[model samples]
Target: MTDDVPAQSLMLPVLLRPVISDLEKTDVAAAQTLRAALVKVENVHPGFTHDLVLGLVKKADLSINMNEALLRLQGQVADTDSEYRLRRAEEPFQELNRRSSLLKKILSRIPDEITDRRAFLDTIKEIASAIKKLLDVVNEIAGYIPGSTGKQALEQRKRDFVRYSKKFSTTLKEYFREGQPSAVFASALYLIHQTNLMIVTIKNKCE
Candidate 1:
């Protein structure tokens, strides 16, 4: 019983960012509603937090792809409103975005059922898989654009994913099994943020 108690006592570190508190104190009054909603949930579930952060990462990626697709249509279509083959390329991002939203909703509903470390890690795998799929989709989309720069940008993002994938694997081995959930989660969070910033830079180049 004592041994079981020690295992049960293991807790995820309180490394969660002060997201709600910071929002309340800052001049970002526009986000007050979101802040309020978050505060209402006294104990923010880790799984929910994972989904939210991952959702934003996925959204940023899709936005980058959408922006690139629009750029591909540039000069191809008579105007933004005109029909073009490149415009159809945006359908995949739309589908991906819809899937991200659905994932968030489903995860939010299942947090109570996934507090086990193994289960949470499995969800992390899902997030990683989703990011990989997005990377592949971006590459496929770039194929139809047909430009050296476009191909180069996609290749760069692919390289970034590979780096992050390695980092994630290393962190998972070093921290997750050592009972350090915060380290593993933080590594994933940082990777997503970094990748999103990279994608944003690529999107800006499309302009």
Candidate 2:
């Protein structure tokens, strides 16, 4: 697989068909069982099977450094949020800190390796949910700005935030589909750091 391949375009069925065919040649029963499990997972969580397969392939290739990458992400989140207390009001800062803490907790749950599929899936979902909550807090902060000039500035920042969020999501998805765990974690950290900066910017404008 090449980097040029789009994440959504890399269908799990297409990628697994040939591999399953080969597996069936050696062990038909095993191949059938694997296919059935994948189908069940896909039914419950679309696109997850693709991520799982890509992750396994990358793990086999020794391309992922999960522990180190996660540590770096955790550090980045901490460093970015360290300034929140100084830059923001007490209430907003506390909310932001709470959200950041939740995110860090979720990040800590991801293991050094993808040993358990269900656990990894749960962690990923938690991470996604935490990120959305953080973004919503930032949006709430943005909504409080008054005056025409502040509103205009907030609008521009909101546009930038939305654009960057989309880019982050796309890049992260591509990293996952390509089985680049380090890249996935880095992209996630980047988004969180950018979010912190956005909150600071909005707070400044509000003041």
Candidate 3:
């Protein structure tokens, strides 16, 4: 029994390693999918897409650095300690991973060309809904962290997302009534911008 307990305890960290690795992989894949979707939008709205794409690229770079930092931290921790923290945070990480996968799937629905207005509008609406779900998960994860600053930052992000979502809704309504593509495009860009910022905030504060 004694030998078995030691062996099982030693195996815990090894088992947990794949969970962190998988989360990191999911995050990277989601970022790539989102970037691709933005590029497709760029083809249609050249004037607005460039800045958002640039911002996303910068944030993605930061996310990579943060992931490296997390790996380094994991290595620094004692095996038992690492296992405990990983186990504690595992559920939030899994939830975040799940939401990110859903976001990627939704982003994939964005058409390559915005030629079909109804279709494009429907896709953005779905994207908006997915983003909201992601934000909710992020906010919940942030709540578990200790610092008030992190919580406050997440709150601000929530407020920003709400504002962007409202703009999207209003512009969507305008698009339906007057059929001005520009307004809808602008709102969509705002949502995308907010999403990138929220992602960066998640890395900065939550992770």
Q: How close is candidate 2 to the true structure, as a TM-score?
A: 0.51
Summarize candidate 3's per-residue lDDT along 14-42 as a digit string, tens digits.
Answer: 22334444554769776555546644564
User: For residues 25-53, what per-residue lDDT tens digits would candidate 1 score against the true structure?
Assistant: 77567456664554345255424543454
Give the poorly placed runs of model 3, Cα more than 4 Å off.
1-89, 104-125
Better TM-score candidate (1, 2): 2
Query: In the order shown, what is each candidate's alpha-carbon RMSD?
Result: 16.1, 18.3, 17.5
Model 3 clash tally?
0
**Residues forming the 10-long window of minimal summed lDDT in candidate 2:** 1-10
Local error of candidate 3 at residue 184 (angstroms): 2.0
Best to worst by TM-score, what's the order?
2, 3, 1
- Quality of model 2 by C-alpha lDDT: 0.57
Off by over 4 Å in 1: 1-89, 96-115, 144-146, 205-207
Global lDDT of each candidate: 0.43, 0.57, 0.52
Clashing pairs in 2: none
Give the Cα error of residue 17 in candidate 3, in Å.
28
